[model samples]
Target: MTFSADYLLDRIRLKRRLRIWQGIGILAICAALLALAARFDVFGHGDHIARLWVEGIIRDDVARDEMIAELKRDPKVKAVIVRINSPGGSVVGGEALYRNLRDLANEKPVVAVMGEVAASAGYMTALAADYIVAREGTITGSIGVLMQSANVKGLMEKIGVKPVIIKSAPLKAAPNPMEDLTPQSRKATEAVILDMFDMFQSMVMERRNLSKAEVSRLADGRIYTGRQAKNARLIDETGSEAAALAWLKREKKVPSTLEVIDAIYGEEDLWAGAQSAIAKSFFDKTLISKGLSLDGLISVWQPELK
Candidate 1:
């Protein structure tokens, strides 16, 4: 009987220790999850305004789309400010970002704050917002589409080198660098550019409430200052981000006390930044070698040289 009692006590003690350790493990996991949720702002602690920044060339849409989706899912995010600073890039990239922002605007008031240069597709992105604000000297409109190709046939001939291309159709590789663009190929390319240009123009006219004649007058691939854009009705106001926030508070009735959080998507940690920097160097070199070919139509601003 004594032996049995001793054995039972030992078992009880072991079970108690096991239960304590298991509880600690579960608590550790819960704490880890809570920390992660806090880091990601998953807990709705306070009302906040999301600031989604579009800087440099608008190349890829993945990060921006993810950020937009996150903001959309967050109930604490009452409004959004889209800050744009870019000369623009691929038409498809810009269009995708614009649509994502538009979708976000459906749930919250979205205002655009233009930085130094928001031309081409950058300006198109601003059109997705409820209102646009820009600095007086901010460069804004370059409403057009452009397609360019280099012909290296003469260079190859001079170098006694030729590139042979095999295609099922004559226009399969039309406007190739190894040959001069045929009249048919040029016409086909122009048609594609014009179609993209028309889409851009229509979006601008519809968003800015500009007449077709007004759009025709301004959409000649011309860059405009912020003041000029406002005068032309391309932008709503000539101001900075503060003006945008004020507009949100007064017009949209967003609370002035709400916290503004930058929700821009990209690398956040030092290790990630280092990795991205290394990768970006290679990617930039590739783009330069390929003449920045985005493999589709582009809405980019290239200033004409006299």
Candidate 2:
């Protein structure tokens, strides 16, 4: 059977189109299978582990709050590991997070793994965990409270800057650095700071089971190495997260089969964090990328002063 060239060309084109469609159909079938497997959790077990990374200043922000809330609500999650590398922040902010962590611990095994430095309020939150682990050289345990104010009175005088204030109360501008602090105001502020310090001491005592005297000695706003913390009975152990998980399994009988899930801040959260990083990057390259910088919000519990 002799065929025309046009007919043969059309037949070839039709075959090529059919092959393309067949390839697409195969791809679609594979995709459908994958979707069904994912939907049914075919490979998904009850081991829905989650992790939370608490880096830098432990701020009283929506991101941190939402993470805590999700951890509490996730039933599939057997335990939570809070990876802390903060120096700390506002006394109230640290306390709020500590309280939240404490509550979360009650429901599930919440373990804390200290990164390079978890001092002051950072350690305060760590105490709320069922177990606390630190690296060998980890600088932890700056158990204290602090209030900082810039005393610009000297600079103001040097620059011939005289400030006039109108306030309802005598102590309204008590912490004004542009002027000399009155003895009465200093005393009042000191009293308030002492009260906060006392509360911090109390929280430490409750968590570590240390007597008032023990806590007082350790809570003198000092940083301790992981070994020192262990010796002082401040930290439960001196190790990493893996060691902590092993301990939990052996000592606490958390079961080896219990899944180890790192509670990440989710991909959606990544968008916001990325946005924040981009915004911060405009001011300084190291601001968002590195840990130490003076251009941003400083954590109150941070021991190192630049």
Candidate 3:
């Protein structure tokens, strides 16, 4: 009898589901203890709630956006510090995120607390903040536009493969991946990139108060160290999450007693947690592989090559 990986995964999933209720029971016990301790004033400090952490990739999705919107509207939150650690993604993705951050800043003092890497579209999303706080060695910048495609014409010729297409205009599929790019097609692609780059430059200029020439100097698709970014006026300060929070309290005059709570994905919501755990379990058992494509555009942060 042969036992395949899929069969093993199915068995594991069944066992995991059987054990889930036990895990939930343990969680309930822990929560009860915490609640009892809090009721008894375990730390002797009064309850405080004002600030929270907004984490993860900012995309066109409604979940993250809705959470951000709710936090901005909450009266208890005096200020917001965005914990940004993304390498950036799509153009529309960056633009939508920037708009939300800008809107949040309008109501409260919003600061970007950058992590290890916040480049390209990441920096684009950070432009709307009142201040940008970065660690000493954070990687930032890479202000430019990029679009990539692979040409498989040579491979098709070698293997005798071809793609047939029907379109109204010749230019519609002129830059087909299975063929060489024509001059006209290359020009068209360059035009699109140039327009996006121009928009990025304009945003930086308007937000950072830099002249067009100054923005052009830094927009050469080069990333900079946190220290270098501060010197170049790209970032406001070099600091960690704690330092950013302290600055918000001192400089921004957020209430001293206000609590700094982390706004996690679940945020003590049981339904959300259950759904996430279930999805995670399913992926881990059935979909995870050694050579999965964890690269490409959507990654919030990626390491630079040596």
**Which candidate should be chosen as best, given TM-score against the real structure?**
1
TM-score of predicted model 3? 0.74
Candidate 1, 205-251: lDDT as tens digits: 88899999999999999999999999999999998889999999999
- Model 3: lDDT to the true structure: 0.71
Off by over 4 Å in 2: 1-45, 266-306
**Each prediction's Cα RMSD?**
11.7, 9.6, 8.2
Write down the lDDT of every candidate, Cα atoms only.
0.83, 0.73, 0.71
**Structural similarity to truth (TM-score) of each candidate:** 0.79, 0.75, 0.74
Quantify how close model 3 is to the true structure by its C-alpha RMSD in Å: 8.2
**Which residues of candidate 1, in runs, are more than 4 Å off?**
1-39, 42-45, 268-293, 304-306
lDDT of 2: 0.73
The candidate with the higher lDDT, 1 or 3, is 1
lDDT of 2 by residue, 42-125 (tens): 667586545677767766666577678777877777778888888787676688788888888888888899988898778888
Candidate 3 per-residue C-alpha lDDT over 1-306 given as tens digits, one digit per residue, 9 for 90 to 100? 989999999999999997998898877666555544433336553333323333334456455566668768767667777777767776777787788879888888888888877888788877988888888798889898776678988888789877676879757865678767888888987887888889989999999999999999999988899999999999989988677777877888776667665443433454444433333335333544332132222323344449
